[model samples]
Target: MDVIYVIDILGTFAFAISGALVASKKEFDLFGVIILAFVTAVGGGMLRDILINSHPINWIGDLNYIYTILTAVVCTFLFKSKIAPLRKTFFLFDTIGISVFTLLGLQKGLSLNLPAIVAIIMGMVSAVFGGVIRDVLSREVPLIFKKEIYASACLTGGLIYLLMKQIGVNENVNFIISAIVIITIRTVSVIYKLQLPKIKDDIFTRNQ
Candidate 1:
């Protein structure tokens, strides 16, 4: 199998686990957890593929994606107690998922001859919209809408990958560098509590 394919499967697993954990936290039953896991694993890719008019979507064309998500849900349930106390587990998996999904989505867009900007948007959508769906379902504010840099990291990585590809960077090197840049930026921002500057609360208050 292609290394990218392997990474994509792993990313799907990670996203599913993150979803399952969140569902558990929300006191969801088994069916709800499974549904959430499936959604979080492939919802973004499905949306992206639909937008691009890609036939069969992604998970539809690949049984491995479905299997991986089901396995992740099982593992999450089996080990929830052991892993639940690790507050950082969800963040770790989420960061990894976005990093892989972003590049894969960007690659797909480019393969379809999309514009760089559109490809970047596709990458961002693939990386975060699943989580957006998860958060919306769980009645929590999505991380991308928060002050922290979430989707921004994916967009930055997508842009960097496109720039390097245009300049003829080695494919493996470009992928590695872009993924690292995304993971590093996300980790550092969260660790240091860095955030994009927000409009002051008074602005909204004045509007009201």
Candidate 2:
């Protein structure tokens, strides 16, 4: 199997687990948990493929994706107590998911001859939209909109990937480097409590 394919599957599993963790935190029942997991695993990819007119969609054409999601949900369910305490584990998986999805989406857009800017946007969408959906479903503020360094990391990684490609880097090396850059950025941001500046309350009040 291709390395990208493997990365895609791993990303699916990671996102599924992340979603399941959220569902469990919200005390959702089994069915709701599985549904959230499935959505979080494929929602972004589905949107991306639809936007690009990729035929059949990804999960629709691949049973393995479904199996991977189900497996992640099951594992999360069975080990909720143990896993819930391990916040770092969930963060790690979520970081991996975003990194892989960003690269995969960027490559897909490029393959379809999209403009560089559009491809970068696609990469950001693929990396962050699933979590947005998950957070919306969970009735929480989405991290991407809340001054977090989530989508920015993906954008940075995508740009690095493009720059590397332009400079004649090997495809696999570029992929690895991009993913590493994203993962490292996210990890450091989280660990160090780094965040973007938020709009001050006075800015909104002044208009009113």
How well is each residue in 125-188 modelled by candidate 2, as lDDT tens digits?
8888888888889999986798688898999999999999999999988889999999999989
Per residue, candidate 1 scores C-alpha lDDT tens digits across 17-135 of: 88898899899999999989988889999999999999899989988999999999989888878767865866776787688899999999999999989999999999889988988
Estimate the TM-score for candidate 1.
0.90
Q: What ranges in model 2 sit over 4 Å off?
A: 201-208
The number of clashing residue pairs in model 2 is 0
On a 0 to 100 scale, what is the lDDT of residue 100 in model 2?
89
Q: Give the root-mean-square deviation of each candidate in angstroms.
A: 3.0, 3.0
